[model samples]
Target: MNAPVATSLLHPEFVQRPVPEALVQALATRFGSQCSTALAVREQHGRDEGAIAAPPPSAVVFAESTQDVQDAVRLCAQHGVPVIAYGAGSSLEGHLLAVEGGISIDVSRMNRILSVNTEDLTVTVQPGITRKQLNDAIKDTGFFFPIDPGADASIGGMTSTRASGTNAVRYGTMRENVLSLEVVTANGEVIRTGNRAKKSAAGYDLTRLMVGSEGTLGIFTEITVRLYPLPEAVSAAVCSFPSIEAAVHTVIQTIQVGVPIARVELIDVNSVRMVNAYSKLSLREEPMLLMEFHGSPTGVKEQAEMVQEIAGEFGGNAFEWAERPEDRTRLFTARHNAYFAAVSSRPGCRCITTDACVPISRLADALLDCVTEADASGIPYFLVGHVGDGNFHFGYLINPDSEDERTRAEQLNQQLVQRAIALGGTCTGEHGVGIHKQGFLREEAGDGAVQMMRAIKQALDPQNILNPGKIFTLQ
Candidate 1:
């Protein structure tokens, strides 16, 4: 097959080829002020929230239109130079890093909502538009995009990563939300994958193929996403549990009984402490579940009561309510900022984030074991989860300068992924398999599947010029 692309979780070795001088001149001549070889811009384009420290791209190009993206890709393809798509720069798995060094196409300026079809429950927007921007654009329409990664991330970036968040328990992830895409292929040709229609027995699901490709297959220029009508009633509550296992069991039982919880998140005791400190709140320093229910008022109350009873059986107590809109926003915003809270809890500490998803039956086993291992390691860490879906993240805190700490964290991550796989789970549930999870992806997908992916990559971009050295190394 592809001959075992990566043998380690560390950054892949990339050959740095200088950007062609002729290509640079041509791009500058065409885009003038939109092209930049400045160190500041290149540095900004190079790094993300990932642990890998790859070299920056040789240059950065601001693309304001699909034609702009096509022109840039055409020039880069002509020179056989890599082109990394840049969105909100919030990818956690080194998806945006310019590892092979070529050009970064920043499409943030193309932020425009092209159209909203409330009748069809779909909206078409440029890749540069952020999720919050899209929501704000359609706020008065009584419909909202349900896929939220909580980073104010660009829709393009979210689509590439196939991201999901707390609401994923009910609404589903990007894989379910994205209906179609206008993609600029590696050869600079534009192709539409599907349409705004809800469902069809279509040929191949190209929309899905491009959804989580992380810009390796093609660059998305325009996207159509499914939308949901605003819920008639929404209620949020938080309950603290005596133990992590108890909190997890509560989630499992609630899901098993079919509460249809709109959002159900798990916060470990350590994370709750850090979050309380960082967000300036007085919350119980114990394992907690933050839940939301949506439907008619009676339906919301029924779901909440069922969950409360289930939580009580698992030692959950003192459920607090965030019934007001502002309160709910504050609560969720704090949960979304759990990464920041964990990092700030230890100044100058870098985070090695883990996204492990296991079967609901094995969620407790997986999470409890992980927490026990982290506790045994005596490393500072924080945890948060969308446990209703059996997906969670652990932010392993490490001093940036300490290779020893990094090694320990990587070991713990490996152990967790192995455990999840053994339990019929996945290495990543929401976060895309960027550079970080390349090894685990192979282990999870097998050599045959990986080779199939590599074959597709070669067919689409023979030069390996689009986000090279990501997802897998095409050696």
Candidate 2:
């Protein structure tokens, strides 16, 4: 048990397949000014928001189109070199780390809305487009993509990680929102997984398979996603609770009672304090539920009233409403920045983040004990969750220079994942099982299921050139 955590803490020592000089020259000749070997650019593409450390990729290829991605991948495949896909670089689980030395194919320049089909309620976009960019572009059409994963993460990356955020409890995650994809296979072949039809009796469900593949199975070039119409009326509210359990129980009851709450998030007292200091807002320093309701004015009012009554049963304070658009934006912006706020609370500290999601019935049982354990561990941390779906995160802040701190934090994370799995939940909720959660993934999925996944990976990417050394090691 300790061994897995230790392995997770140390940077993976996979055999680094050297990027042959011939391949580098080929990339330079093909891509011309688009290929860069400069140290700064390589370093920038090497790591992400995750704490894991690894040497920068040998080169960074800026892919501006689907053909560019295909060309870069083809060149790498010929040389048997690893390829790591880069987007907004906002993934929290080390998903973008170039663990086995390779070249990073950055798709940020490929950002563009290919088409918007209002009648179909779907939008086709290049992988590089961020969620915020997509929403801003489609806002005037009375439709918006609802997968808001806090950061302005790329649609491609979000789709790759199968991310869902504040709106997931209502609109669903990337797994449900993504209708189809144009993917570049390991051998540089482009394939369309499905069409924009809402339902299909296809031979295989490749779209779902690729949605959360973490860039291991293939590279995404184009994505078609379902969109929701902007609500006729929306309201945001914050209600404080006397204790963490009370706040969690309120969410559990809200969910169990079928409140149809659009977005419901849990922010612990520690995180609220951090947000207060970082965002310069005086939210009550107590466990709080930040909620949103969307529908007709009457429907929204009824939902809010029902939730307020439920909160009252759990010793919650009065609801502070944010009905105006700007006010709601300000409140949600602060919620989105909870991660940065926690990081800012402790200067020079790195966070060992935990994503543990249990069943709604087990949320209180899973969360309360973990809270007690975290407090007793003497680690400064912040707890926040999209608890409307029984998914929560604990960001354990630790000194980068202290091995003991890292070990302690990993231990806490291990325990948290164990409890969540025991409660019939996943090791990761929105964050995919990047390098960080590979051990927990095996525990959750069992050896036989993992072997089946390995077989699929072997069949799709025989050379292991696509984002090698992620999810689970091939060996």
Candidate 3:
């Protein structure tokens, strides 16, 4: 293990990378009480939600402001030490693993809503604020941030991963929601990019450059995200289908017909069963579409009627709608708990969440075939999707001690990813590659594109000090 976080060395690779002790001393002196070398704390913050391995960080720093990030980064640059930016520790792709251990800068404290520009429909917030926190703060303002990445993730981590969930089908992902950023470049200078205005004739869209960069190019201090007006009329509905194909086809046709669906989600029969047993959600045990319509009362009425007609043509079960605030809350809460239900299907088992997206026309075929494949494999897998976007997740459960099962699951995951690539879709629609997709990046983005990304990395972080050994390996 590294000189720091010498504890939690049960795994061979956890924080074993070399770190300069003199650099740590210098940083410690500079940050004083703000810096910490406590092994337990560092270990706690370093773990990610990856199935491969979750390593701990060597050191930890609770950053209070952008200046603190600058001080820590400058020290790491001088010493050529790796720095890992820690968020809420909810990264499913091992994005926060301190592979080359040094200091893990935790931005949990810098969570303040700097400004809510209602005129521009944007909210400027410190990256550390969680999505739920942001929503709660702006609940009374009639504006909401809508990227729901499953986890109550920090805005910074979500931006780093370009994360999204059910709401993205209507509200869009981080790439679409983020309007600008206050980022600290490798040189430790905090600068602002993008503007409060909706459109910009600016030179380069550097604001978006950092959205999915995963902290490789720079550190995000503040994020300005586009917000949506709370719907004047809203309703949630569930439409059960006889088969996955029928449900997917319904989603496609609903969108094709110009139905302004806010969230159209699919849960296969197996997934519904898991949620019923685990979350005590007594919904019908069938392939179902959980949908939301947002607009004026007349618009919502028209959209709901059109959606119901489409579902009926496909032999869908009777559709049920919830419009009251309490009913809406209950419906969405159950929807959000789909992941927990999948994991709890096998008590005390870790989850393997594999996500992908395909063209809307091909979504039905892909999902139907995947359900067949999942059933044939005889593994516990839950099928759920943001139907309107053709992006879905197969949440698989495996006991940590079952090596053979884990290996089989890995093979299944590889097959799924390959299938998605063949269909002209991304291996990960919203989740950043992190360590999980490093090998597959080339198969998606060609060698030349990868090379350019590496060149940018070298230029920004000459010392390879800011979140090193991520996005691309230093050659």
Better of 1 and 3 by TM-score: 1
User: Order the candidates by TM-score, highest first — what do you get?
Assistant: 2, 1, 3
For model 3, residues 1-475, the per-residue Cα lDDT tens digits are 1232211112334344567789878878888888888878977877777675655666788899999999888877777777888889888777787777778999999899999988889999998999999999999999989898778899999998889888987888998889889988888888898888778987978877788998898889999998889989998898898888899999999888877799998998878898788767788998999999889999999899999999999998869988888987777777778888777778888877788899888897777777777788777888888979989888778887887667767777777887888888888887778766776677778899999988888887787777766666766
Q: What value of lDDT does candidate 1 attain over all alpha carbons?
A: 0.90
Q: Which clashing pairs does model 3 show?
A: none
lDDT agreement with native, every candidate:
0.90, 0.92, 0.82
- In candidate 1, what are the lDDT values of residues 322-352, reduced to their tens digit? 9899989988999999999988999988899
Which is the better candidate, 2 or 3, if ranked by TM-score?
Answer: 2
Cα RMSD (Å) per model?
1.6, 2.2, 3.3
- Give the C-alpha miss distance for residue 113 in model 1, angstroms: 0.4
* For model 1, the run of ten residues with the poorest summed lDDT: 1-10
Error of 2 at 456 (Å): 0.6
